[model samples]
Target: MILTLLDRLNRRRAWLRWGLLAAGLLVAFGLPWTLYPPVATDIVCWGLFAVAFDLLLGHAGLLSFGHAAFWGTSAYGTGLIAIHSGVPFYVAVLGGTAAAAMLALPIGYLAVRRSGIYFAMITLAFAQMVYFVTNQWRDVTGGENGLQGIPRTLPGFDLSNSFVFYYAALPVVLLGLLAAWRIVHSPFGRVLAAARENPARVRALGYPADHYKLVIFVISAFLAGLAGGLYAVNHGFASLQEVYWTTSGKVAMMTILGGIGTLWGSLVGAAAIVRLEDWLATAGFEATGLVTGVIFIAVVLIFRRGIWGTITHLLRARAVAPVPQIEPHLEHDHDELQPTPTN
Candidate 1:
């Protein structure tokens, strides 16, 4: 009886998840109509960033303090490529993602050797180096001023308009999200889960745990770079602030606030944070960081599992609760009602 009840609950939970996904799709497609086009675009870009960070922090069990290196580098690369090469916007974004992967190779090679805080420190250190390089390379990067007038174009269409560009660029973001989902559901993803839980056991099973870690790190950087490139194009500039440590920290906050291991949760977290910042800015609140930090602290202390995680936990708990046991005679009556087979 317990097994049967669990099975039914499991089915119900699956249906609920599917329903949520459908609703989420509807929201994604309709958001631009309700919100400012630029804000809607920013939400999607930040959502991608959060999802990328979660892949590394949540699934790979690695904490990085310097993902801004990937994001910032990609932003600069995208702007430079478009300014000089005059390639299509999507092509430039791809170029930027590719460059981020290359940058990740050496960083991941070194960072994966350490775990815990050491790993984070190494990434942070490398990110600082990248920031220095970016600041000094004024000829290309535009130093403190940043690169402005980066074009967003498709041969025939005028994508300079924010509204037109948001829809055009959205499909690429969706494809990136789909790629993440596929990776998480793949066999390699199982190995990542095992490594997250028990690295020693993964090595005992003959898997080169270091290789897997490096691969996922690069993959995460690629996704982040993709987001950064798109962001620069959408805004028509690449700013130095994109490479700042706070940007990396912000994405981490979004991932944690949304439920780190849940990809959709990352999007939810992004929307919440982005919208809050937007609202604060519009209201002329100067201490945006203070307000955001206070709310983040409150959420962490109250909903330790994060918004999505806590909600799902409550649902599962209710599902597993014993239904009032059927009356004892009800079972007996059901057996009596069953027709006996003739021998």
Candidate 2:
């Protein structure tokens, strides 16, 4: 009876986790219709971008400082396609994401060979190379000025309206989030996590650690590129600033602020930082960098695990009810077993 009861309790816990996740998704879907719709939509975009960063940094234990390469490349690619081809917005976005992934394959292959700070430096250097290319290739790239007048269309849907655009972007963002969640929960994710924890041990088990890392790097790049494409459409332009190293560093800070390994935490951190910066700027704060830096330091010092981690920890602690001790027992047929015991 006790075993049966324990089994049921475990099942209930699993169901509850799924239930909470569904509720969170529903909230995200409804957010754009609520107050501050534009801000909410922007939050969704940055959230998706941050999740991509977390995928490589947190899940794969790969620190990339040149992720802006993917982000900016996708934005520019999508913007150019939108401007020149008059293609459907979604198709353009996909093209952008594919371009970013293709770029990641060669770059990530070389960068993934080096771990720690060297890995980060390789990514940074590669990003700088990309930036320089965009700047020097003035005729094609528009140099420092960036690509302007990018089309913001939703195909059959009339996306000239803000609400229409918000709804359109919301579904894509949700799909991206779902994909990220699925990837992180699969067997691939387990192997990736194992690789991160101990690459030597994982290789000893015959798993190709480098291959897994490269795959994840490409995946992360693809998603970041998707977000960048969406960003271009949302703003109706693609800028060189999108590919800057500072932008990459800001993403790293956002991910760390929200909870390095927690996917949702990255989103939360991005939203918080963006909103806070917006508010501060409106309040005559010219030195936003100084304020943000101080806050980042404070967050790192106090909430090292980030808001989601802290919330989860608190909730779990609150749920720590006393567990009842169980003792084992056996029942036997007295007549048959008693004779054996006596013997």
Candidate 3:
């Protein structure tokens, strides 16, 4: 009976998850109509970027301070391809994503050898190298001015229209999010989580934790690249700002704010950060970063589990809470209780 009850509970949980996912997707699909197309696009792009980062920091237990390298590289790659070649947008995006993954291969190999802060510093150093190269290569990258006038031509779609472009981009972003979700729930994802909890134990089991880390790093970079490419196409521009260290920091903040390891939390975090920035900009708030920092501190202090994490924690707590026991005397007649005492 216990096993059957547990099985039924698991099935209910699975259904609930699927229902939530479908509802969320529906909301995402309808967002462009309700919100500005540009704003909606930003949410999707940044959300995907945050999810990618979470895959590394939340799942793999690796903090990389240089993800902007992949993000920026893919943006540039996609922009160059779109501007110089007659290829479709999807092809350019794929090419850019592949380029980022390739770049991650050697970087991850080296960075995986280190752990903790050392790993972060190594990644940051490499990212700085990438930034310097892009900045100095003025002829190719257009230097500070960056690349502009990138073509938005996609077959059978009017990408020139913001609404159309947003719809076009939404599916791709959803796929990326779904992929990340699958990664987090899969056997490999379980191994990655295990590696995060105890690298030595994973290594002792002959899993080669470093290899897992490297693979996850590459995968995360590829996803970041995909987001960047989509962003570039959406904006019709690619610039050094995308690859800057600040960009990396912003995405990191998103992951943290969204409750880290929870994949959907990344989207919530992205939306929160992006909307807050937009509102601040419109309100002529020059101290936006200061305000954002204060909010981050508050979140860390008051809700250490983060927004989504806190919500999930509360739900779980309620689910497992013990029921209050009633006194037997209250349920039985007073006379019956007296007779029982006599017996």
TM-score for all models, in order of appearance: 0.92, 0.89, 0.91
Writing each residue's lDDT as its tens digit, candidate 2 over 141-258 gives 7888898888876567788776678788877887888889899999999999989998998999999999999999999999899888998888888888988898899889889888
* Candidate 1, 25-64: lDDT as tens digits: 8988998999999999999999998999999998999999
The CA lDDT at 135 in model 2 is: 80
Q: Give candidates' CA RMSD values in order.
A: 8.2, 7.9, 8.4
- Alpha-carbon runs more than 4 Å astray in model 2: 1-12, 320-343
Q: Score residue 189 of candidate 2 by CA lDDT.
A: 99
Clashes of each: 0, 0, 0
Q: List per-prediction Cα lDDT, in the order shown.
A: 0.91, 0.86, 0.89
Cα miss at 206, model 2 (Å)? 0.4
What's the TM for model 1?
Answer: 0.92
Better of 1 and 3 by lDDT: 1
- Which regions of candidate 3 deviate over 4 angstroms? 321-343
lDDT of 2: 0.86
- By lDDT: ranked, best first: 1, 3, 2
What tens-digit string does per-residue lDDT give for candidate 3 at 1-343?
Answer: 5567667767877887899888998889998888778888989999999999999999998999999999999999999988889699989998899999999999999999998899999999999999999999998889999988878878777789888899888888988988898999999999999999988889889998998999999999999999999999999999899889999999999889989898788898899898888889889999888988889889978988788888888876766434444467566567754655431
lDDT of 1: 0.91
Q: How many backbone clashes does candidate 1 have?
A: 0
